[model samples]
Target: MLCLGAADTGRELCHACHLELPWLGSQCRMCALPLPNDGQLCGQCQTSPPGFVRVVAPFRYAFPLDSLIPAFKYHRQYAFGRLMAELLVEALHDAYRDSPRPECLVPLPLHGRRQARRGFNQATELARPIARALELPLSTGVLRRVKATASQQGLPAAERHRNLQGAFRCVRAAPIEGRHVALVDDVVTTGASIRSATRTLLDAGAGQVSVWCIARTP
Candidate 1:
């Protein structure tokens, strides 16, 4: 396979690995899943309101699309983050046609030790571009993971919420007060982490908190 970076490839991204992924697709607007290329909210979201006001996932976390995520997340290929973020900005435009916009964007924070070892926060890297595109303040430090815990993978989906209980805490409330803040993350496997994050923001007095992830495992 030709490398995406090679001059002869002449491709912005490697088609063999993944195409230019659409961060915003014809998804159930509430869940961010591909619909029949139409509508605002899907049947599921319309029936019941999720804890979050809205969830906007640009892509389904599958196939070759999943590969590049780990490349940037685990190995620090920061450029790929730019692609993910741009797609998310598109998703945001599609999601908020009628609703008022958020005041700021916050990246899902990593615990101190995990970040110290990994040397960076993957979510923060991905959030940077969207924050700039939206002209929204990025306040990651406001919410933090006080505890470093097990990977969400391999856990039962029902137990996911319990596992993440109290995992997040808000250090400062000023940034989010009465603001429609959005949470940025690389993926949403179980929705537990984002729930915890929303809990933190709500506790900190955020008027509204929506989740914007690159991909969702739905």
Candidate 2:
């Protein structure tokens, strides 16, 4: 079904609206933070290396996406979730032609209490379609969020990192050793969460871990 106000006869979004979306142009090679120059690491990444080998975020977390993401995540507007996943797949196909594909896709786990309240793991929902499209295994339980930390939304970078300390653990012996893994999420903010989660995967014997997100905050 077409969404309300969709134009161009039979598209989910009209050409103009699509053009107006906050698509990322140039981004940091390491963290996918929006950058003025392409193929360069951001200052933060240069000073302190991140756990993930690379990050891929096709959209900027701004404008329509900021509104759309909250609606999908907080209000259970699932259509937006599906739309965002499809968009990420399209972007990946174009950007990752020569990049190494991960053997498995891991959705960043949410704590049980948070998952119970939210009724679903948004990251898992986002990764399911991507896994199907890419023909890669989706491991939903291999990585578990053990501690329920305070929300990182308004927290500073230092605080965010501290909040996620000891928050993630590997629950299953899933043969992840020497295998590339892609951690999927809806957005990459300060990247503290990805750092903590990737640390767990790395410590658990993942050969290399990459982050795949729909959007990143510039």
Model 2: residues with Cα > 4 Å off, grouped in runs: 1-11
Name every residue pair that clashes in candidate 1.
23-58, 26-35, 27-33
Deviation in Å, model 2, residue 107 alpha carbon:
0.4
lDDT of each: 0.77, 0.88
lDDT per residue for candidate 1 within 102-121, as digits (tens), equals 88998999999999999999
How much lDDT does candidate 2 score?
Answer: 0.88
Model 1 / residue 106 / CA error / Å = 0.9
Q: TM-scores across all candidates?
A: 0.82, 0.94
Which candidate wins on TM-score?
2
For all the candidates, what are their Cα RMSDs to the real structure?
3.6, 1.9
Tens-digit lDDT track for model 2 on 43-122? 99999999788898889999889988898899999888888888888888887798668889999999999999999999
